[model samples]
Each structure stands twice: as C-alpha cells, then as structure tokens.
Target: MDRRKSLKIIGGSAIGIAGLVLADWKWQLADQLTHKGFFTFNEENLISSIVDTFIPEGLPPKVPSPDAKPLGGLSTGTDKFLYRLFEHCYEKETQDIVKTQLVNLDERSKSEFGKPFYRLPQGDREKLLISFENSEIEDEVNFFKLMKSQTIMGFTTVKEVMENYRGYKVAPGYFKGCVDMPSQA
Candidate 1:
C-alpha cells in the first residue's frame, strides 16, 4: 500500500482503539460512582425495590398511613441508604457478600415465585423474609439481620420518618428557671 493509505489505515485503527478504551473507562467509572463497584444499574434498582418491600409506601385510597400521607421506603431514602452503605461504610468484601446474598435471594425468588424478589406478591415476599430470618443457615440469618437493621436505621433516621411517620416535631431547647419565681414574687 501507498504511504498515505497506510497512514489512513493506522489512523483509523488508532481511533477505533481509543474509542473502545474511552467507552470502557466511562462504563467502569459510572459503575463505580453509582454503587462503588458493588452494584450495576439493575442491581441497584433491585436493591431499591427490595428496600421498598421491607418498607412499602403507606399511602391513601387503599391503605392509608396514620397521617394520611406517604411515608415509607421512598421517603426513607432507602435507595440512597443502600448506595451510601455499600459505597462509604462497608468494605468491598462485605459489599460483595451483600451483593451475592441479594443475587441468591433474587434467584430463589425466581425459582419459587416465578418472578424476581421485587416482583413477588406482598404476602409471598413477607413469607420469604420470615423464612430467611428463621433459616438454619447462619449466613442467611445474618444477612437478614443486617438488611433489616440497616434499613430500619436508615428509615428511622430520615426527616420524613422522624417528622411524618413518627409524628415528631423539633423541640426548642430553652430553660425558664426564674419565670415561676418572678410570678410568685
């Protein structure tokens, strides 16, 4: 081939290789930033739904919350909690354990319920969770406990849960020790 043609071919190959590298790097970076390497889009989505099951939306028209407002999984920052938990709090090994446990849960849900865990009927989902909690497998029991406690902690800590769900108001901290003495005088 001529020099110009050879140059063109080399240029095209270099461009193609560079594009692939850029694309791969972009994908990896996005994955890590999204879930700190513990989850992909689907996995993150599944975890969100899983958290929802644990603390579903308590809204009106069917079954209302005590205050007739929505206060549950979405309000509790369940998705954000999981993302932060795996991203900043947990080690990679713990994250991997959580991921594997969730994967196994989904697979079991698929096999037994004919759908993934998120798609299971509410009753079935609750039953499955209870079974896991009572399971003889030490690891399964531990995973259940961890999931429940983290989710509960996350749910309870959010402002929505504190103010709306629990009906707690911010109290002003003040001391009026001398007011009664002044009145008596």
Candidate 2:
C-alpha cells in the first residue's frame, strides 16, 4: 500500500474514533439529564406536575415559595440534590418502599375516596397531601422522601422564593442584634 494511502486510512480512523467518543459523551449527558434516581422522564414529569400544582404561582411577599423547576430544568443545586437522593435514598431501597406505599395509597383513594391522585380536586388534593404528610408513610425508606426533600430544598433555595416570597434584604447585617430601646415617655 502507498504511504499516502496508509496515512489517509490512519487519519480517517482517528476521526471516526473521535466522533464515536463525542457521540457517546453527548448520549450519556443527555441520559443523565433525563433520568436521575428512580425518576424516569414520565415519572419526573408527573412529580413536577404535582409539585407545580401543590405550590402554584402567586405567593404573598414574606413566605418562601416552593421549587417549580422540573428535574430537567437548570439548577446545579437541584441536580446535585436529585443525584444524591437517588444514590442515598433510591439505591438504599427507599424508592421501592415509597413506590409500594404510593400504589397502596392509590388503591385506597380510589376505593374509599373515589379519585386518583392526579384526578382529585384542588382541595381534595391538599387534604390528601396533608394526610400523606402526617402518616406513617413518612417513616418508610425510599426515594419519595429524598425526592420531596430535593423539591423542598430547591423551592426554598430559588431566587424567587428568596427575594419575592421570603423577603430577603439586600443587606441585612447592617442592623446590630439586640438593640437597646430608648426610654419612652
């Protein structure tokens, strides 16, 4: 074979290898973005929908608002929180327990309350959510708690919550702690 032809083949091989590597890296990144922990895209969407509904827009200026960014949304804090949830909670069997409890809750709600979680009215949803919050289900080890924690953390950490809802001052340390009041007449 000619030396030029040999060089051409080597160059083509290197380019092909580089392309494959790049493609693989892109695929992995996209996969990680879509699937974090026990939440697939569909499950993530469902959870996001519920979260958005639970903590919808229009908060009074003073209370921290809920996190509205979906799993795929941009937020390093959220991404890290989610990855940890899956690693610490889901891999540790918390996710399985949560899934079972959710399924049981679905059956009970349909039989006793006549509505699926996603189908319930706003008030009913709130009621069920409160009940769920107070129940033994909270004791279970699963991805659910981790997922909830991440959501809450994200919501509270968001800029909107900090500035608009939580009433963050631009500079709060100017005031000294335990100021003495002047004598009043």
Candidate 3:
C-alpha cells in the first residue's frame, strides 16, 4: 500500500479502538452508579421487608422503661447495615448466594401465596419465613439462618438499642481505689 493509504488505515483503527474503550468505560460507570452497594434498589427493599418481618415494628419494651422506643428492623436501618456488612466483609460467593436467595424468596412467595414477599401480610410473611426455616433445600435454609442472625446483629448494635435497651455506657465514671466502705446496719 502507498504511505498515505497506510497512514489513513492506522489512524482509522486507533480512532475506532478509542471509541470502543470510551463506550465500555461509560457502561461500567453507569453500572457502578446503579448498583451503589452490594444490592440494587429492589433487592434492598426486599431486605428491608425481610428484616422487618424478623423484627416487626411496635414491639413493646422488654423492661417497660419510660425512654424505650418501639423497636423495629426498618427503623434501626438494619437492612442498610446488612448491605454494608455483606459488601465489605462477605466473600463474593456468599454475597451472590444471598442475592440469589432473596430473589428466590420473592419468587417462592409469588408461587405459593400469589403475591410478592414484601406485599404479603405480616402473618403471611412470618409463615413464609418459618417455611424457609423448615425448608429441606440447603440454600433456602442457609439463607434464612444468615438473614436472621444478621438482622439481630444489626438491630442490637444500633445506637438506640445500645443506649435505651441495653444500657450501654460509653464511659463508666472514674475509678477510685481508696474509698472507705460503709457499715451495713
């Protein structure tokens, strides 16, 4: 080929490659933005529903303290906490299993109850979760167990629960080693 023809071909190939790379980069950025955390919006909503079912709203205080608020998973942001935990701490395989199981749970609810898991009544939701507890499928059983434990962990670790329910003290006063003991009457 002539020098000018060879140059034209080389320039065209480089431009095409650059364009492809730019397109791929833009696609990756959009994907990352849409999936900000480990879960998508719908998956996060499913998690919120599942956690709420595990720890429903308006639970009366265990000790009836005046400052105790009605405890619930959603109110404590347990779903978000779980999301961060899975995103940062869990293995990729575990995260994929949990995500798949969440979708499966919704599909199961629709198959059996004619509605999505999140839309089911509170009692129905409980019954469905209990069914998972009794499920013979290993994935179903594992998913249920993981979700239950994580929900409890997330709920108990929240600031509200730590302060109001558990009476967690940040600093328990100064120590004094030379105090005189009072005599018992």
Identify the candidate with maximal lDDT. 3
Query: Which should have the higher TM-score, number 2 or number 3?
Result: 3
Ranking 1 against 3 by lDDT, winner: 3
Weakest 10 consecutive residues, lDDT, candidate 3? 59-68
TM-score of 1: 0.65
In model 3, what are the clashing residue pairs, if there are any? none
Report the lDDT tens digits of candidate 1 across residue range 72-183. Answer: 7766678777777877898877777788888878888888889988777778888888888999987778888988888878888888656755667688577777674444
Error of 3 at 13 (Å): 60
Q: For all candidates, what are the clash counts?
A: 0, 6, 0
lDDT of 2 by residue, 1-185 (tens): 59999999999999999999999999988986777555555344345444544455443443443754332223324444444455465544656654555565456557767866656665765665556666665553333454466667866776655666567877887967899989999
User: Candidate 2 — worst ten consecutive residues by lDDT sum?
Assistant: 68-77
TM-score to native of every candidate shown: 0.65, 0.45, 0.72
Q: In order, what lDDT does every prediction score?
A: 0.78, 0.58, 0.88
For model 3, the stretches where C-alpha displacement exceeds 4 angstroms are 1-36, 63-67, 175-185
Q: How far out, in Å, is residue 81 in model 3?
A: 0.3
How does residue 155 of candidate 3 score in lDDT? Answer: 93
Instruction: Give me candidate 2's TM-score against the actual structure.
Output: 0.45
